[model samples]
Target: MTGSVTVAGLGPGDAALVTPEVTQALSRATDVLGYVPYVARITPRDGLRLHPSDNREELARATHALEIAAAGGHAVIVSSGDPGVFAMASALFEALETWPGDRHPEIAILPGITAMLAAAARAGAPLGHDFCAINLSDNLKPFALVENRLRMAARGDFAMAFYNPRSKSRPHQFARVLDILREECGGDRLILFARAVTTPDEAIAVTTLAEATPEMADMRTVVLVGNSATRRVGRWVYTPRSAESAAG
Candidate 1:
């Protein structure tokens, strides 16, 4: 009897953001696996098989979690932010493809609040229209891919949010993003940086793509580059009129 699999979203930087479904899933999981920082955010369950590691160990950890579930243990693959949005959900499926076991466990991915959505809501309405999320880390992907995505967003005039924009090893990648936007977008494009949204020390600031310097951003910052239609109303930034407002 193989135990079920639950890919849970732990939410953005707060316990309060944990959904009831995710909380229920965690309560039933026998093995809870995730990157160490995310795993630590949840309370220690009575009998959870806790496995934590650095970000570099993602594949190995996902494989181990599946193995545990195939062996009839209730297992959970946890991620910060929504599990499916550039998070752990894809890794679980990819790892399962190479799995040799016959045991098919019930795998469920419960959704939760993502950092982009939460950050946008906290700072105002930066993502009030069509948007894009681009991950800047070149560790797993090529730098070309990152730039290509940026180019796409710039061309589409999509409101853009960036993830994993910078780290110790890749400090200047986000600066390149700004350059791409400034070249494709105008010099006055509204840009907002929301750091640690919904957390105790959260910071939100509005700037233009031409004005958002590297010093104003870090890995903790979720960056928002506005679309052609996006605009700032005092502290709040918004775009794409709602259907109700449009009809009126």
Candidate 2:
């Protein structure tokens, strides 16, 4: 009896963003495990157990979630944003490989609306062209890799969406990203700040790269750095092709 774990992105909340498929899976789930805030979104039902864990206890939380599913029941792991984007799916795989269990359960990854996409939508398609997401947190991966990716993205002329830009402990990470961008793409590059999208107190701000500040962003803000080809029209920001620009 192989039970499977289904990962669902609950979107920003219980509003229109919740997909029919996610709702169906939630209805059928024997247990739902996630970081505390994500699991708090849904109402609990009979046989629908909720396992909320500390956010930093990622690997352990995933291992426990899988164990629950392998015990002859259904399980779903909830990630607030897209699981693959920067969420639980990879950690789950990593934990499995770190301590491979004899009883392997079926696992499946489902997509959810990522903060960057939702942020882009609110800011009028800043990610219309090439873009990349880099986590500025150097605790896991070295900052050198982060800097390398930032430089590469800048040189490649790609719009950038930076995740985990800053936290309490690591406060100066985004400054380095900004400096790199300024040197590579000039200070005139437009930037969109989407902080805590879909939440009641969400904020959206647009500014130039020269004016971007570390205090303007935190772990929750999805930083958007427009490519050289990117532009702003009225309330929207987008990357337009030279051919399209000429045609217009």
| Candidate 1 global CA lDDT score | 0.82
Write the residue-wise lDDT of candidate 2 on 1-248 in tens digits.
Answer: 67778888887553578778888888988999998988898789888989998878888888887787778678898998788877889888887786567866888787888888889988887888868887778878988998888888888778899888888897777787788889988999999888989888799999998998888998878888988777889988887754233211
194 Cα displacement, candidate 2 (Å): 0.3
Deviation from native of the Cα of residue 40 in model 2, angstroms:
0.9
Lowest summed lDDT window (length 10), candidate 1: 239-248
**What lDDT tens digits, residue by residue, belong to model 1 across residues 1-248?**
75777889988888889899998888888888888988887688578768887887777877888778777898888898899988888888888888887655678889999989999888778788778988777888899988888887787777899887778787777778778888889789988888988888799989887778877888787888877777877778887654233210
